[model samples]
Target: MKNHFKIYISFLILFGLTSCSKLLEEVPKSQVNKDQFYQNEAQCIAGLNGCYDNLTDIFTHNLFKINEGSSDLAFWALDDADASFAISPANPGVGDIIWTAAYHGVMVCNATIVGINKSPVAEGRKKSLVAEAVTLRALYYYVLTSMFGDVPFYTKEVANFDDLEEITKLGRMPASDTRNYLIKDLAEYAPALPQIKTSLIVGNRVSASLAYILIAKMAMWEKKYDVALPALQKIMGIYGSLQSYKLVDILFRNKNIEESILEVQFAWSATGIRKTTLVAAITTPPRTANTSIYDGVEILELGDKANPSTSITPSDHLIDIFNKYPNDIREKIVMARDYNDKWFNRPSRDNFEGKPWMGPKFWAIQMDNKLDGNNQKVFRYADALLMAAECYNEIGNEAEALRYINMTKIRANIPILEVYPGKQSFFEELMDERGRELMGEYGRKWDLVRWGIFYDSINNTIATENEKIKANLRPYHEFYPIPDEEVFRSKGVLTNDAYKQ
Candidate 1:
């Protein structure tokens, strides 16, 4: 009973307390119950863990679907909601999924902050807990604004049903306001977080290094290279070098590695608080019951035959890039051509043939074949290096930019260029480098969007392959539609005019 209660409390924070309707219906009683339930440091920490669990939910599904699927890196086998840009206020697929999940995470963080402030824990412990909550809240908002453009932002915990009316009436905050608020929150609380966690189990928790990475990313989005450089330098000062290329494969299998700034942890267990990640199931190609061959090559057993659903596949452009730079070590680790061939030969029943490349970064040989224990990486040290190179280049420090970019290329076992010729050429190289390095890691769409090239990039890469995709994409498609439920609930105060149907 005690063990069950512990699990219940640790995981229950985000359930039933998500939507505005539920907020009005259940928050008063839920808060009253939790007020009595949470009083000590252990309980407070458990609540904080609950907040982190929402991140797992966010990245495990829709967030990746929207971020990576919509990018030139990938496309869906079927008519996926966000991938096709078919989202509307009426049918807000990724928008609804991510919007609900992110705000639920924010709500949990807000509750934790309010509760922890009133707790009897030591001041130092209290400070750390609050710092983590604040940092996480900032991240939730960052994702929200990044995806949905403008979002309903709030800091207060909904402790009672009475708060519902005011909350539902709130309009979408401007994107600049949202970014500034997040920057302020992160800057204030980042120093309070520890530089490194004491143990691996708690490694996924917020740290000063992770906070700086988020800050740098947000600054880069605003084209404030000056603000981003210091944060990138802070990360380099803390963790001096990138994890070696030889260990790149091992980096995904293991947790709390030097390369991983933050990752959502999953345990391979039949019954546990943390089960397996969905990446394995979603990314892995379906195997055949009988062994098959294509062009004298045996088909790779990428995943289980019984569980056959490869919803997302790598783009042909991605494969061409890898082929163009065959020496790049990331190609072997990030994708498998054999798996793609297998899928191509034995196409799915829906006539969805696989692309030339498939993501294999999170593939695990599951013993039970139920779920995979692979962790979903959020921020990586390589990303820091790439961002650093961009910042340096923007600041006209071509020498410094090459220095950082070369570190990544050297680690990839690729030859480094001696000169970049000009800034435009260098920027193009950086774009390709980012695509090669960060493909299938869920940052591609936003990366292109931030660079103001999403539309052109998509049309240029995919128009020849699928004219329908080129026709579907619009300038406003860069920002997803606000969810219909949210707009209806807000009584037109919150609306995405571009997606109105």
Candidate 2:
């Protein structure tokens, strides 16, 4: 999609109707008759664009809160009381918002797919558009199944109120079935997507390489190293190298670089509300009182009344890890001691009060702090390399694994490792490296969960924060509870036994 593209009014009108109710709810037959609306290429593309809009909605501050805050790397600063252990179904925190947003995306994709299939658009265009919709649907389901163990699955779009009974009566699909479905969908449709995006007009759209990466990621989550390797290898051949970490301007400022596989596009010029993202406002810290340290440097304005800064500070553990690799440029780029300056070490308790270490990865240079146009990086080449390294290590190819790991390290101007103690040790190093490299980008909680370390890691290292967090670290906490609203809406069909009464 073009950075400056306007969301079509037709799409807004259609999707607006569906968003008001559950994922399975139907629009009035007179309001948006899919048979009448999706007659030509423009309408079908608009329907696809509606599907893309769901992604923008999903990648918001709420998503960041649930994904990262639930992990050990960060915690919700605003609602620490209820948010510390937001894993419970009983406590409807950001997870419910995430659940609703993801399913909404799925619903839109389903509608788009159904509409495109019926449209009289040319066979090639119809197939490609439907493929895109299918891929997007799979992505939403992938996220849903990853977060909420089993989720209500649907392929058909709701056409009328009568369809609600059938849709609502459906139950959650097992996570294994969900993964297999995603793998199959991606594999089938990925080839239809362009291998490389040739222009900025289509830059943020998913590509074949991205689909492969997603496939590999799903396989990795299931510990199917063999299944993930070929896809990762395919990605390596297509996007061969990582963007140099030394080129700070190209690294963060420029969107859709050689390093970027998939990013949520945002531009100040894009039409519609929130054309820009609030990541800058959410991640940036409020300026400290002592501004004399950087005499003339201007601090990026923090929380405005309209869009207040979220004050999401990095954990002290993350700070210490970065300090271990002081020479690494990634450490400098991702976090800071003061505004726009690299954090070398943890400051004394008193010195660290207002100046909590904050992630600068998404902080754009623009002075308008509220409306940031910085594109959020969803997938990057570096993540692919790390994933490939992990796959190789799992399969006992330590040499190949280290080669990929060292390649990433070399780009950061850090020393390459010549040895690893064992596979477990290498995996530990990888976990740390991923935390350092992709800290503010989100994905840590899922990573820890897939690694089967969520409980131990949080209880051992992170639970010291409070008794509430410690008490909430049960086995079932690995999978978030389905939102109570969703269960209530499902009536007897949906259940939330995982949550404590």
Q: What local distance difference test score does each model get?
A: 0.71, 0.68
Among all candidates shown, the one with the greatest TM-score: 1
Runs in model 1 lying further than 4 Å from the true structure:
1-29, 197-203, 243-247, 271-274, 290-306, 339-355, 367-371
Error of 1 at 220 (Å): 1.1
- Global lDDT of model 2: 0.68
lDDT tens per residue, model 2, 422-467? 9998898888888877776657878988999888877765566545
lDDT leader: 1
TM-score attained by model 2: 0.85
Segments in model 2 whose C-alpha atoms lie over 4 Å from true places: 1-32, 197-203, 243-253, 269-273, 288-297, 300-310, 339-356, 367-371, 466-468
Q: Residue pairs in steric clash, candidate 1? A: none
What are the TM-scores, per candidate, against the unseen true structure? 0.87, 0.85
How many Å off is the CA of 391 in candidate 1?
0.8
Per the 3 Å backbone cut-off, how many clashing residue pairs does candidate 1 have?
0
Residue-wise C-alpha lDDT for candidate 1, range 324-396, written one tens digit per residue? 7779978766765554445444233255544543545756554234366767777777889999999988889
